[model samples]
Target chain A: MTDHRPDAGQPVTAVGEVRAGGSPDGGRLDYGGPWRRVSRKYVGVVVAESIVTGVVLAGISLFFALVIGAWFGWWMLGASVLVTVVLLVVAPRRARAIGFQLRDDDLLFRQGIMFFRIVAVPYGRMQLIDINRGPLARVLGLSDLKFVTAAASTGVSIPGLPAAEADKLRDRLVALAESRRSGL
Target chain B: MSEAGGGGAQRPVAPAAVRRAVEQLTDGKWHRLHWASPLLKGGIAFIAILAFVLANLRERLVELVIGQTGGPAGPGGGGRGGGGGGDAGRTFNGDPISAIYETGFTGVAILIVIGVLLLAVALFAVAWRMHSFRIGADAVEVRSGVVFRHNRQARLDRIQGIHITRPLFARLFGAARIELNVAGQDAKVELSYLGSRQVDELRRELLRRASGVQRAEAAAAVVAATTRSSAPLSAAGTSAGVVGAAPAATTSSPAEQSREAGILNRRVQELLGPELDLDAAPPESVVKISPLRLIGSLVVSEFTLVLLLVVAALFFSTFVLHRYFILFLLLPSVLGSLGYYVRRFSKAARYSIAATSDGVRVGFGLLSTSNDTLPPGRIHAIEVTQPILWRPMGWWMIRINRAGHASGRGGSSAPHTLLLPVGRLADVEKVLALLLPGLAGADTQGLVMEGLVARGRAASGFSRAPRRAQWLRPFSWGRTGLARTDDAVLLRTGFFWRRLTVLPLARLQSVRVSQGPVRRMLDIAELHFNTIAGPVRAELGVIDRRAAVAVFTEVSAAAVEALRADGSHRWAS
Candidate 1:
């Protein structure tokens, strides 16, 4: 009965009891209650990854231009710089778009701005919960939580949670999954 | 361990032969598979590797001939594979099989093959010795690998189904592969190359054991049903089943009773059975598609249309355009299509659907026959589709989704997934009854019929998409709808290819309602019923936003209730 998918352009509202790392208008995307946003530090990880990739691409183009005597090197350099700039610009919005809500019966996961997808994975059907952290994510103290279900296409993963929050959510989810363990 | 799963003391006593067979395994002693397990399982991979080695040897031999005849690096040299046309022509002469066969045991090819065979035997022998399985009260455990151990346990309560596969080569040795499918991503628990009879016996015993989880709540519900103003219909059915089960245990009617024999001398009715009753199956259960109709459907298909066009063009190029050269390139493709047509035809020749005591058996194939059992409630979803080509003939194809990868066969070109290739409306009804016993109700049957073909009936009881939603689905908007029954939900969609999907509530993993930018603008949404991966994509699109929310809540609640009441997970018990 709740308007779970409020418009992305809705004005910021008071988060009330929910505080998810200063996400703007996080309260507006509430499904009965406010959604929990991922850590904003995730933007840094994306930016850093983009910069490293850009440097590699620029170097490859430089090598071609200076060493291999290739004319397309200039075009390749332009493309890589344009891509890195676009990636840097969208990193924050992409992070903001990622949010999750833990309802009584199921955990709802949502991501993507242009082509959005919202998945509901029932607690009773959780098979396993895994926590993963890459070198960059680990440096930023962020963990990505993934849970498996009997269905191959459940595709439920929540990235960019602060380490402590990720651990707490895992514990709560494990308890919920076990207590209501309905075999597929 | 046996007591841990708790099938309750009042569990139905299995048939004596089945009980004895099960007892041998459930004693918790580890058992090794058949001696041929190594040879049969490794044969394919070994042959593949040998073929690769032999092909290389053959190429080297060809090169030697080329080097000797044409001398080193001739002026006409091309790619390494491009041996001079004359040398290559003399060797194969368009028949590769005969070229190999004619060579026989005359040369290094034979020696290399023999040596590889010996080494493979030695390695696989070790692998066979390493792999062992044990059946405990609650789980079937398998352990393999030498240095790096691989231990897998399939909980009996979580078993989806057990399937016996006899691949073409394995059948020559009267061997079968047993794969125990459970509900998880990495699901197979395989025991390869068991003797045919042993496989039958083992599969039966395994199913009975796996389906032994306790149903205390179900028993309580039955007792309550009988006592609280007894529901006459179910009470009668229960009493009748009880009466039948009683006589089954003490099988011999008093006068014919002989001295009780031990397990060693067990006789009269203890032979292992095949999955299908191909010989004496009743008329009602047997579904045989006529060859004429099969060919007719093929003629009307897109595949045949393409083939016809290719042939027509080939003829046009050869005659009208006076281009004989095109024949060389196009001739093989025509022949390949013909070969494909024959293969598809053979898949339908001996196809039969029969109901066995174990489950509904679907048997097909001409030479290396394969059939598997699907017990009641194992089916999660059923989809009946009518492609525009088959609409005139009123033919429908049925595909199903079960928990395991083994089940489902009804779509195009997937082995063991197509439940039915093509059938009439009445045939679909009969097959539906076999898969979903809950559809036996008259009301449910009516709903199914309406769902199948209710294009003009506005009052057909299905919740259709709003007229405004036609912005999305122009042609299919009138027919695309969602309906529900107590047992399952029916989602209808498609115009050019009509599809009706029925997903049981108990089988639903979760419920999701999604709205995209366009749908949000149109005040509509899409509802998806999450289920295990299979052919049936069970989702309803272009539904009104309000209805989507209402159905989402309703399904979530109903699914929870269905889970509480579902005893299908342990159907036999």
Candidate 2:
């Protein structure tokens, strides 16, 4: 048999380089293919959510100020503003951190800049592949690909893929899962 | 609805199936348990409710006495018979004591309490009458329920094993509950409230049937073996000669007779209908935990360490903080941990593991003994762990994950999933031999220890995390590694309490490769092998990216090969 050992001593290759070397059509298996970023509009959703929360907190603070006292209200408002600013700064970085890759027999999902997590769901173990479009995602023409596996811990939710691509991915994954599972 | 009405011609077949099922449930010497079985089963709940009611009554009576003694002309006494209807007036007027007795509330409460007791007794009787179990030729059927009848049948072929459980009250009554662990679905057939003798015989009969022994043949074989053993050799020889003289006179062949005699000598089991002596030769004992060792294990556990920490903190507080307040706060937790340790590991005091024909049997418990049979190929994964403190003593704990109802963290306390609570390296080897018999004679012990608690890397054919990965793990990077065999992949990690997870190639559900920014900085990635949801979770963190990729490819390939070889998805049996 031919040796299939990976070159472990080699310098790590950049993800961008790996992606650039892969076929643009995304139809064939590209070993260590480039990571696919979620839709940029997801950052907008985050910003919108932050703004809503900020507004709610400001309203509550205003109510407390009118009904109770000014010191507590002003403190609450200041805290809300601080939180809103922090969220605005972090949202885009988090959105950029989300990425997924489809391999020959499994789907890989990686998320989080800090407390990072990477999950892979084997095609054969895939019990359900669902496409969910929230109101914001629908407005942005994006959907989330949810892969449910036999192992609860291995479930993956890839958010912010274009609607058409999500549908195609779901169909392909369902078909692959069925064909692979049929062997068992 | 349309299908039901449209299939009218098939209606007769449905009823016939039902009739067959009913006959199967009630046929061939159905047995009822002792009359006190229900009382023993539901006694706890009944007593709890009765106690609550009596307490409330006592509190009311105490208040009445205090009020009457304090002042007869008090506000409550004067307004007694004032307003409301006849029942209310009777409740308020007359002597305060008489009024209290005449009140509808107390009367209604008493009546309702009595009524509930009566209903419970009646229902228990009905349930007792309705519940009857019978061992059939091919399956064991249990019929129960009064209104919407329930008839459950577990086919012998599909049964995984028979688990006998004796709760505290059941143990008091010398009764046990038998649960048939079936292969597919969550529907388990249970025959509860059986005498110990009956439980043993029924378990044996069911297991025999599960092994494809026909009931009639087993019964006849039992009879023939008993007679031969009881009779003199001369009589036996004459009977054998008579049988040989007329071959057609006996239904059993000579080969069968010889096999029966051999089985009788080996097993010597007595099958007297639904009751039998369990004194037959038991399965070979692999390990029996000593009480001292068990207590030692518990004392050296993480809980005990925390308890010790709190006690030390209490001592330090006397000098440093100069207040005993912290001790008060920590006392409850210390006591709680003590209680938890006692309750949890107390059942494991008498832990014993034995090897059966097709699987392993574990028996343990102090007050309520539990006997569980783990059939071959049911264990999805295994974990052999060594806490830091346990390493000095060379102690190991073996846990397994099987495909069934998920038992959360509480499952660790259960004896069924715990192959070994605490054992030496030799004991661990014995358990591994029983669990992974195919891997025996190989360097399994070396592989397990090297992958789990080894201080060095690369000595046991393991692929270790890179040196640079120490930034993430700090204390444990050198110890974390993965080892692969033809049948299993072992992943080991952790510094304080080391964990080694073994996932069978056939049971792997998925493989994940993940890298964070920090891991990317070190050129390493984490690999996770996901099996069915259970205790044994396998994840190799912070390995070289290339090695992760190789593992991902190799494990996926092995999984596919295993699928091709077996082509069966059921993980348990």
What does candidate 2 score on TM? 0.66
Evaluate model 2 with DockQ and give the value. Answer: 0.19
On TM-score, the candidate that comes out on top is 1
- Tens digits of per-residue lDDT, candidate 2, B395-424, equal 999988765443543542232667799999
lDDT of 1: 0.65
Q: Evaluate fnat for each of the predicted models and list the values in order.
A: 0.30, 0.33
The C-alpha RMSD of each candidate to the native structure, in angstroms, is: 11.2, 13.0
Q: What is residue B309's positional error in candidate 1, in angstroms?
A: 3.0
Which pairs in model 1 have colliding backbones?
Answer: B408-B417, B409-B417, B409-B418, B410-B417, B410-B418, B410-B419
- Tens-place lDDT per residue, model 1, B430-505, is 6665555522223555677778877642638688889987899988887888887876788888888999888888
Alpha-carbon runs more than 4 Å astray in model 1? A1-32, A42-94, A112-114, A134-136, B1-134, B141-152, B167-174, B184-186, B213-286, B317-330, B356-358, B406-415, B438-445, B456-459
